[model samples]
Target: MTKNRHFEIFLATSPGLEDMLCAEVKLKGFRQPKAVPGGVTLRGGWPEVWRANLWIRGASRVLARIGQFRAEYLNQLEVRAKEVSWGELLRTDVPFRVEVSCSTSRIYHSGAAAERIAKAITETLGVPRSETADIIVRARIENNFCTLSLDTSGDLLHRRGHKEAVNRAPMRETMASLFLRKCGYNGQEPVLDPMCGSGTFVIEAAEVAARLNPGRSRHFAFEHFATFDPEAWEQMRAVKSQRAPEFHFYGSDRDAGAITMSRANAERAGVTAYTTFNQATVSDILPPAGPPGLVILNAPYGTRIGDKKKLSALYRALGQRMLEHFKGWRVGIITTETSLAHATGLPFLPTGAPIPHGGLKVFLFQTDILK
Candidate 1:
């Protein structure tokens, strides 16, 4: 593709996080970003695709719309698919996979449509099709219109190439980043996670404070494409706008194993210097010296097994601790139950939309700076 040509680049984010991801896109200087239901769409070429994968922390995947056509029958689908410049787009050395989904179209059989497209590509480009390939070509047939996109991010972006260990209460990095952004954290001050399972929140906050790119240590599927430029990608990725953080991010967990996992994950993420993980219970927490910032945590929803009463006591303890010691600090808690959040008894502001996490929908209940 030419440098001046603009393609439709879609950055996929979790549900209820579209607008927040759009704000990040605008801040990163992407052109004409519009937030939609499942993702945010913008206009750019290959470089924009690379930057979106490398820079955007909230996006789960970056999809580049490569082709679009109308196909009513399998014959028409094959013809249109052959017209696509697959050879120019993908290298013969790299095996690729095709995924198809159909809705309200004459080509109702998804398997048939996929096989047609796969056969066309194999015949034309002679590239092997693998059931599991890092390079993915996705097609959505909706209302007789087919739109093809490259899943430039093969693995989900949340696997940030660090964090070899995690606790039972695990949170994906992408969701953690959005929740932190929703809490009005702009990397200006300190952050703490009392129930910091695997240290997702604390480490994300520390990375933001240091101006580190989340995708720095990972490999994306886009690197395997024929259009990838090694020199250009290296130079762009090498440009680090790192800022030394003034305050250390804090995390405390009752589980000693959780604390150890948090420390190791921070070291792998290269944020150990900017973070401090303590083995402490909620009642034992003391606000760090120097400033009052944000205290955010993803608390247990008490979904599995029993003993929700004990969980309620845990929430009450957290609330009491925040009220008594964390004066002037804002608080954000994510939980699946409203009653549990209310049990915290912190004066919380109205919450945002519920975010789908695991099998449950969790809400972020935030409080104004404590009195």
Candidate 2:
């Protein structure tokens, strides 16, 4: 557990959410968090890497930048790669893989670079290399400088490992958490998703209210490293906060199957006690019996060639319902087009940069407390 030495820890996020991830990292007390292009960078060792994978909600993945060297030739790359302390980093019994990318460099063959690095590691650490291994070493050879980073997160952090059922175009939990933060939600007030697909928004809100760790149910890649301390990792993962929330999160959909999936997903996440799912349409949606809170949704806006005439009606109905029953609540709509958001006729503030969803660019349209 190198308690004294630290490495450059990078927390990856969606393209448009680097600053939000940085803020979350800083609030979690990681040392010197700075927002770079696609993620947040900090300084920490193995324990910090574990905590990052275990705690941060807005991050997509966590990476540990192990070592770097300037090598204009493949022989120099192999020699310097052999100098790295692979014995201290990787386990001899575990399998690993290498992936390399080269740009504007003398040693521009990515496959050759990967081969050299893999040979060096296999010879030095006696670890078997597999093409399908979960543990990976990523190399970026840009401007003739080779930068090495280890993917400490095996699976993407968005997968909380609890939800077995997901609806079409489902929103990821990591992105949902950041969207909630963008809507100024601190988990104090109730959250409702009228068109809740798989209960992602509601379940995430409930977990936040309970102060549950997003990564609690998932396994991280760092757990397989030679330097991993299972006892210390257990202690870190076991810390629970006392700030429990009392309000409930609500979700409703017109499809009975969606409601069923929502309930099951919430149950699997251990938040069913604080969540309520109902089957209803946009016209039938109603606010919960509590203080006015947030009415957020990822309504089904069709693809580029989708029927705009019908989607407009859906947006209008959602807007009408928000105005009728949720007078004091704020609203957030995640959609692909501005025209659909405009059809709602709600007074929206300036929108944020386009966020890359599954394959489409989605925008978050928010409003002030409704009049």
Candidate 3:
């Protein structure tokens, strides 16, 4: 936490979309981004940390690696933890929380490890511990090596501070952005979502096309850190390079209420001018009049026996509509069951790994532009 010292920054994402997130981080100019299992990693100082929280769309949370050490025992762990320059990273006036996880090391009890680290922070930095604190210190002891990091993103990044309304099983904005990226959306092409619950995909696509920063309307936990520079952050957030999108994003759903929600959410997200929401069923869907684009939908994959039977027919109808009307449009369908995807008969290429979403494992089934 020394002044201007670079540290490892971890961008957390859904498990199956690490490569997509890594590509986004690399495009955003993060230094040497490397894709790991659950996320991406890079090295930078506090300014880069601030930028990541402010601009990156695919990351679910941002963690700043403050420091690490080898600790074989609790006493040694406590001593080393206390020696970390907590004052440089945390404010004594801010209440903070410590979370610890131990694996394959002598520190088997996570609670005891958390308590020891909490005690060290309380005694050395004079910071009060609070379970409800927004600032979080995370410690992981794996194979006798303890790495400490700060959760710079207090709430999950998907809470983009917009979209007050949502439908049942709506896709989060973080996951939606990554899915759009996986579908080869880069803001130039228009996007359409036939099952646009709450308009997540359409709104996210419009934001990308307009060059709007996902975190523009939200706040981050790093604002509470001792290293926070409000002046610098103000400048960073103010210098948005937004442009008017030439192509419009589109969405529709069978339910009238979902269309209302989509319009409201798009207006709240400041993309209403660039988006259009309509009330329609799968068979009623048609491509917009201008050009070929991407059609992505999070189709319903019901869990119950009767629900699955109903959803299969729904998927079949949707596929039939796409094949008949959406020629020249690429498609990305997200569903928990490949059987449902196959029911579309859309000639989907090799599917991506299944991603965990809303307690179900979902895969992205993509197709080439239909002839």
| Candidate achieving the largest lDDT | 3
Worst 10 residues of 2 by lDDT: 299-308
- 254-286: candidate 3 lDDT, tens digit per residue: 899999999999998999999999999998999
Report how far off residue 51 is in candidate 1 (Å): 0.8
What tens-digit string does per-residue lDDT give for candidate 2 at 1-371? 24457889889998999988888888888889999988999998888899889889999999898888899999999999998889888998899999999999999999999999999999898899999999999898999999888899999999998999998889999999989888988889999999898999999889888988889998989889877889999999888873557899999998899999999999999998899999999999888897999988887777743487779988988888888888999999999989999998899999989999988999999999999
Better of 2 and 3 by lDDT: 3
Comparing 2 with 3 on TM-score, the higher-scoring candidate is 3
C-alpha RMSD of candidate 1: 1.4
Compose the digit string of candidate 1's lDDT tens values, residues 1-371.
44446889999988899999999889889988999998899999999999999999999999999889999999999999998888768889999888999999998998888899888889999999998878888999999999989999989999999879977758899989988898899999999999998999999999999999999999999899988899999999999899899888999998899999999999999999999999999999999998999999999877832366778988999999999999989999988889989998999998878988887888999999999
Ranking by lDDT: 3, 1, 2
Clashing pairs in 3: none
The segments of candidate 2 whose C-alpha lies over 4 angstroms from its true place after superposition are 1-3, 304-306
Count of backbone collisions in candidate 3:
0
Candidate 1 ranges with C-alpha deviation above 4 Å: 1-4, 304-306
